[model samples]
Target: MSISKKTWLLIIAFFCVYVFWGSTFLWNKMAVKELPPFFLASIRFTSAGLLVFAISIATRKSLAITRKQLLNCTLAGFLFLAYGNGVFVWALKWVDTGFASLLASLQPLIILLMMRVIQRKKLQWKSMVGVTLGIIGMYLLVSQKDIISKEGMVIGILMILSCLIAWCSGSLFVAKADLPKNFFVATAYQMIAAGVILVIASLCFQEPWKSPLVWQDNTQIAIICLILFGSIAAFTSFNYLLKHVSPEKVTTSSFVNPVIAILLGWYFLEESISLQTGIAALLLLTGVYFINSRKRDKPVVVAKTKV
Candidate 1:
């Protein structure tokens, strides 16, 4: 590839991961307004998974995998899309897209803690401070009187917070899990497994499906956008970025995505952001920056003085 062509490709890739992924927050909120959350997510993920699998096959990518890899994909799919994303879509009925994004942005800090606690990895002071600040941000965001006043607001927020936990846990697992060597193949399998699990969960939850909602144009558009842009385009671009740029650089989308989500919510959804929300967003995003950007050369150990 020529230099100019590569530059354009890089820019387009960034846009895919940044803007498309960010816009899905609002698209998803719109989708749930017409259909049940679990049902909405199930359809979106199932379509996206099939699309990705077809693309992988078309590209002649290796689809071979071990039994353990399939099991790992199943476990990850259940944790992430089935519980994490499914509940998130449901919670959008109560929480605005911007607030949801702020809550979701807590993933980096949560992942940092997961690494420390679950993997028993030593972390730097930055991680500790970032997590503390993130918790404080969470408190401030929820402390808004309007938030607490709404019926089921606490439950909605808690569900979204649990979404953060599940998403972070899944990320950790994906980082270390034994899966297909190809990133796209592994992700395709993960989505297929997750789609099946979510659809079953939606059925068990008795999400309304035969309603007039199935014919809504806005709902259809939102689902299509989510499948095409959010899942397919973003995943492909992210994997491409991983191959071309440093992982740290690609992860900057975490910062940009929430900000885009907030702006899109305010402009498109007319979601109000209170002063407290703004301050909390600042704190939360800063904490995420610290968690992802700062690095300790090694685990710090304080030597005990001989008594």
Candidate 2:
């Protein structure tokens, strides 16, 4: 039997989240090389948010939202994008792109733990094993002598971990929070709210902003890709998938992202993958698999957004 149109759309959406979202690490790394993290993130989100709005209008979707929804959107934006993403990108200043993606692969583990705490749910056998492996993998990844010896490495790792917490918190919020009926409009609201806050934060931090015209060509191109593909297309696809598929299935991106990121970093940036990193990746990704693959008493539907 031939696939339906909906099937095709789902396939396309999955491809966007898998490939485009994974490539965001490289794009963010390139942009952050010359621009302050807040500045880069602010511009990227604001521009992408506006573009999303434009798309909404072109498609004749209503933009109206309740006051409560707007507030929820703002909070989600700050948690997911402003602090979660901005600081993560900042950490990239001191961390390798591939290494950072591998760190991000731990998000599933973090989210599972968050569920245990917030929902007061007991961990299953698989979840417990997964958490144990995740801890061991994290230690192995960060405790590497060559990685830890680098200046600012410890700080970078800490910041990324903090960002993971923020992101996991946002994921939990978005699952049950009231927001716009239209996912695109909701995303636009979140992106714009995040962009505005990032702008203020960038100012407060005394980050000198320069005209985009003066930015290096590669940085400019990377920013464009971030706006068009990373923030807009891939994120929309992610939201779409969460609605159409089980959250567990959508979360397979966690596994795919790091592998794609590592390969891209190696091919494009010549980043090395140490034997230690490979072992750590095996353990971490295996833990993620176990956590995601565990049998459930009921269907667990968790909504997760991207980097």
- TM-score of each prediction: 0.91, 0.95
By summed lDDT, the worst window of 10 consecutive residues in model 1 runs over 298-307
Q: What are the clashing pairs of model 1?
A: none
- Each candidate's number of clashing pairs is 0, 0
Q: The CA-based lDDT of model 1 is what?
A: 0.80
* Model 1 CA deviation exceeding 4 Å by range: 1-3, 211-214, 296-307
Model 2 global lDDT (CA atoms, 0 to 1): 0.89
lDDT of 2 by residue, 31-108 (tens): 898999999999999999999999999999999999999999999999989999999999999999889998988887
Best by lDDT: 2
